[model samples]
Target: MHFKDLFVNVSETLSFTTILLGVGYLAAFIVSVLVISENRSPAKTLAYLLLFFLLPFLGIIIYYVFGENYRKKKLYRLKALEDEKLQKRLNAYVYQRSEEKLKENELQLKDYEKLVRLLTYEGRFPLTDNNHVQILINGEEKFPVLFDALENAKHHIHIEYYIIEEGFIVDRLFDILFKKAAEGVEIRLIYDDFGCSLSKKFLKKIAEANIRAVPFYKIHIPFLSNRQNYRDHRKIVVIDGEVGFVGGINLSDKYQNEGMNNELFWRDTHLKIEGEAVRSLQLFFALNWSFCTDEGLFFQNEYFPKYEHAGDKKVQIAVSGPDSDHASIMLSYLSAISSARKCVYLTTPYFIPNESILNALKNAALSRLDVKLLVPGISDSRFVNAASQSYYEELLECGVRIFRYKKGFVHAKTMIVDDVISMVGTANMDIRSFDLNFEVNAVVFDEEINQQLKQVFLEDLHQSREISTAYWHRRRWFKHFFESMCRLLSPIL
Candidate 1:
């Protein structure tokens, strides 16, 4: 055949194939919807089907990415009710035994008593005792403590992180874990697939060392399931039914700033808690384990031990996710912000906050509270970085002090309200953390904890570049265009 004839034939064949693929995809989606509807609520099924019909290819991609169906509200409501019933029984026991402890600590945190009760009612966490928390500022302070605790594990170790990669820091930690596993310590490990896709080989080495590892919401292949919007964004580590670590720090060299990706150092915060608070961390892990593997956790056996008084710091765990009707943990942060009487200091690598949070900060600052926000001078995501600036114009106009950490990126997710209360964990001030991703936060009502967090916040301010009204107004038109584009997709971003 002639060249023109061959080209025409190929073009026609490709077009026919495309039509067939699109039609097949639509049919399969329709079939999935019909099948899912039988086992799902009417409203839930309608929403899922509408999304698939409206977005077509992208919608199907979303369905396969998330780990579970949207029928979670009703299902998990039952689970939550069951959990709450058991929790009330435990709370009564804990409250009676720790009454004196609560009185002692509550007196110290009297300024935040109403705030704590308000959050407790919001279902973020219950009041607990014999809890001690340490704010780990960087990898320098966090990793060593984490490694030390993991090294001393006796009974069991459960960990779930958003990212775990093989690098100089992780390699040595893996070495310790391997030795511990050899010693017959029960080790359970989990990481998010989307966050740690490149770390698969690293996890393989862990598997070789006989550690039980699973990827959450996997997407590459052979994954049990995934939910596009439901991410396991939590970072938790519980060891020997005792010490635990929870914060924004991931297992990567960049977190330490010892290794740089593209010459930008990643900064973050991690917390080390020992005492009654560890029970809350352990419960958080167990619930996640049950969600991933369908194993119910009992308070008997070796899952929990008789936690005693240890350090003096008071800590509580706050949990939030898509499973909840509202983002309770994020709301608790808002409550803390509203409760601020003096200063509000916040640090996060990604500052792509939603409107409510932006308003919170703006309104708080306008109310004459010193609201200081710190983000990275050079962002890992330029689109979000630009959008982050768009709000700066408004925030600055309303008296919010904006600071860009110049020496390196401020990847820490931390906030201290009024130098009296502090919140530390995996949540960021964004739609993804509040609505889509599973997140955990530790709120400490101790004066010491808040002071330490404020100290770190102040030290970081030394290296931060303050944003003036003039600077934000001088942003170029093209940058503003991309900012607007990013803001439009903030829900998905």
Candidate 2:
């Protein structure tokens, strides 16, 4: 063991370590170049670059699984193709009527022509006038109507939910579905593999009851697949082509306060539609069903039955995802905000907005319009809450009033604009909903529904505590820093 030999070994070890570090950094730089070349949002590009350089190995794994935009497009390409094929068939029958309906509602929708035109130009989203829209406040209000509709289902039941947790509500739902199936009604369900907690035993029961259930983008190996990011975050139910449901509420008992699992009072929003608008929801379900099981349920008469003037309400369903040509839901929000004449009130469980949305809100407030945001006082994710809080100071400073629901977790993704337009659906006001997930929303152009939603928003304000700019700025320095850090990393969250 000579000292010269030991010194030589030490020098060799240092040389090896330096080479490894250099190689790792070089790989990170290469990936950063790829990320930037993808033409992604600036915030997202910066987030990926920071992750790559700071935590090269783990960041590479994350980017491999989640950051690859091409993988998402490839995953949903088939669905998009199938949708285009079906949309043509729909246009032959539905689009013509939609155009006529647009003309019929032109007087009421004059202020929102840009929003309507934006959505209509995106294609497949039709504006229907003969829709009977009902605002269901929470699980308590929604479940009864939904169960009644399920019980009255004559031909078939089509349901697609992001989450289907096992609980009393699900038990009741299964009972109705089983009975309906026994009565010769066709039943099909699509649940998100990433969102559902259904076990093998529960699935066996669904199969035994003769209900065809499939998972969206089945993840064979959890740690390997990128399907986790591209989720079907939609909650929709179309029964017999006459009744439809859409909103943030999932098939979980947590959304209901009367259930045995009602530990927390959960606040949410859902819509029940009984008219031509239900056909739009049916189309969305058919697309997902076809993607999951290759079952083309399009152009079926039973799924797109003719309506006889269910009501005078005008409704349009807006959907967006990675497969979409444009971010339709976000555009709808931005349009709604910018077009607002009197006020814009938005309620969402998540509040991580991108640059466009943030600027839109600030500009709206700066224009002397009443722009208010209602978020959760008690959040399920601390990091998300912090990230959401980071934007509050700026919004408040811009004269945009912010409120935190103190009564419960406000899980409603809703927006009311002026006196003639409103939105309720599954998309949150966050990056995930804007870019990563499949989301659908009902943009109602009826004054009655708008007033109803406005009333609900006003009631919720009573339960929420307004955030003052001074108070927000007075938050602890460490918390401000922590939330800023979270905001910096929010693009990936």
> lDDT winner among the candidates?
2
| Candidate that scores best on TM-score | 2
In candidate 2 the C-alpha lDDT for residue 443 amounts to 91
In Å, residue 264's CA in model 2 sits off its true spot by 2.0
Encode model 2's per-residue lDDT on 99-149: one tens digit a residue. 677687778777888888777767466788888989999999999999999
lDDT of each: 0.75, 0.88
Summarize candidate 1's per-residue lDDT along 354-411 as a digit string, tens digits.
5567788888999999999998897778777776776777889999988999987777
RMSD of each: 5.5, 2.3
Alpha-carbon TM-score of each model against the true structure: 0.81, 0.94
Backbone clashes, candidate 1: 6
* Clashing pairs for predicted structure model 2, backbone only: none
Worst 10 residues of 1 by lDDT: 72-81
Q: Give the TM-score of candidate 1.
A: 0.81
Candidate 2: global Cα-lDDT? Answer: 0.88
